[model samples]
Target: MTSVAVKARVTGRVQGVAFRTWARAEAVRHGLSGWIRNEPDGSVRALLMGPAASVADMVRRMGRGPGAASVKDVLTERTDPEPGVSGFRIVG
Candidate 1:
């Protein structure tokens, strides 16, 4: 099966809510490989790569985020994976 990668930007009360940690854990649970981090503009940016269905699910979860996160917008777009990317990371 072909895997898919997507760039996701979650906005609204996302910062300071452990969003990255939550995403990293969820990605691992979903058997996904990618990364997540806090954006300077008060958003959470993430990449979810795995089966198309899994990636889609990840995006949906981003919309909901953790209970503490007030997700206002979950914007996503198809993207290419970085060379040799593996595992979910919470980057600076």
Candidate 2:
């Protein structure tokens, strides 16, 4: 599988809803590596790295975060994976 990376900004009821935790778990499940954080704009930003398909799947999952989260949209961009990055985490 070809490794790839993606940067995503998820908007709408994403903050204060365990979205970051959910995203971390999801990324790990897909064997992705990167970080996620809460944005000042009430959105959640994440950088995911993994197999191309897994990264894409992670982006799709961002559209439907934790049950309490009402994800309205997810803006994603293709990017280079962080060098030597391993494991997904929540960045403070």
Candidate 3:
């Protein structure tokens, strides 16, 4: 399987919601490694690296976010996976 890294920014009603928590859980479930965090601009940003298929699924889930989150947009940029990401996390 090809490993890929994605940098994503989810906008709208994402702040103060369980978006990051949901994202972390989803990433772990997909066996991906990276981190999710809330941006100062009220968006949720994430860096995900894993199998291409799994990363795709994670991105889809991030587009929807948690039930309480109103995700208006999800912008993702595909890139090369980095080395040494132990597990999925919620970063500052």
Candidate 4:
């Protein structure tokens, strides 16, 4: 199976809404490896690398994040996979 690495920027009521935690859990559930963090601009950013189907599923979930997060938009793009990410995590 082919895999892909993607960078996603989630906007709107995302920050301070447990978005990171939700994202991490979701990513792990989908067997993805990546890091999720809050951006200084009040958006949530994530780098996901895993099976193409899983990554795409994760992106879709991000759009409806945690219920508490009113996701307005999501920006996704391809990227080179990073090394050494054991699982999904919320980065500071």
Candidate 5:
């Protein structure tokens, strides 16, 4: 399958809202590999890598986030995939 990687930056009510945990679960459920983290700028950033379709789906899901998150924007960009990444997780 064609694998791809994408970095997504989520803004608006993303911090301190369990967004990282929710993102991790979504990535795992999609069998993706990468990481999600809280940025100091009050945004959530996530790198998603997997089958092209799965990555796209993950990005879409991030737009909604958890119920506590009032996602205002989801900015995404294609990036080089990390070959050593395993399961998804919350990272610093």
Candidate 6:
């Protein structure tokens, strides 16, 4: 399994809908390590790190966040994984 990292920016109705919390839970469930945070521009940004397949799955799931969220778009890009980061969390 190839480990990979992905950076994603999720837009539209993502903030104030428990998106970060939900993402943390999802990442943990998938054994991913990274962080999710709310951007000042009202978008949610996340770094997903794990096996390529798991990260891909997480990205797909992020496209449709919690029921309260109305995700308009999910933009993703491959990136270097964070060093020494373990477990998922909500960060500023």
Number of the top TM-score candidate: 6
- Residue by residue across 1-92, what tens digits does model 6's lDDT show? 99999999999999999999988989999999999999999999999999999999999999999999999999999999889998898997
Residue 65 error, candidate 1, Å: 0.5
Mark the regions of model 3 whose C-alpha exceeds 4 Å error after superposition: none
Quote model 6's TM-score.
Answer: 0.98
Candidate 1 vs 3: which has more TM-score? 1
TM-score of each: 0.96, 0.95, 0.95, 0.96, 0.96, 0.98
* Model 5 alpha-carbon miss at residue 78, Å: 0.5
User: Least lDDT summed over 10 consecutive residues: which range in candidate 6?
Assistant: 83-92
Predicted candidate 5 versus true structure: per-residue lDDT over 3-85, tens digit per residue: 99999999999998889998999899999999998889999889999999999999999999999999999999999998788
Superior by lDDT: candidate 2 or candidate 3: 3
Highest-lDDT candidate:
6
Clash count of each predicted structure: 0, 0, 0, 0, 0, 0
lDDT of 4 by residue, 8-85 (tens): 999999988899988988888899998999999999899999999999999999999997889999999999999887
lDDT of 3: 0.89
Ten consecutive residues with minimal summed lDDT in candidate 5? 83-92
Which prediction has more favorable TM-score, 3 or 6? 6
Which ranges in model 6 have alpha carbons more than 4 Å from their true place?
Answer: none
Worst 10 residues of 2 by lDDT: 80-89
Give the root-mean-square deviation of each candidate in angstroms.
0.8, 0.8, 0.9, 0.7, 0.8, 0.5
**Compared with the true structure, what per-residue lDDT tens digits does model 2 show for residues 20-73?**
998898888888899999889898899988889998888888888899999999
Candidate 5 wrong stretches, greater than 4 Å: none
TM-score of 4: 0.96
Question: In candidate 1, how many clashes are counted?
Answer: 0
User: What do the candidate models score in CA lDDT, each in turn?
Assistant: 0.90, 0.89, 0.89, 0.92, 0.93, 0.95
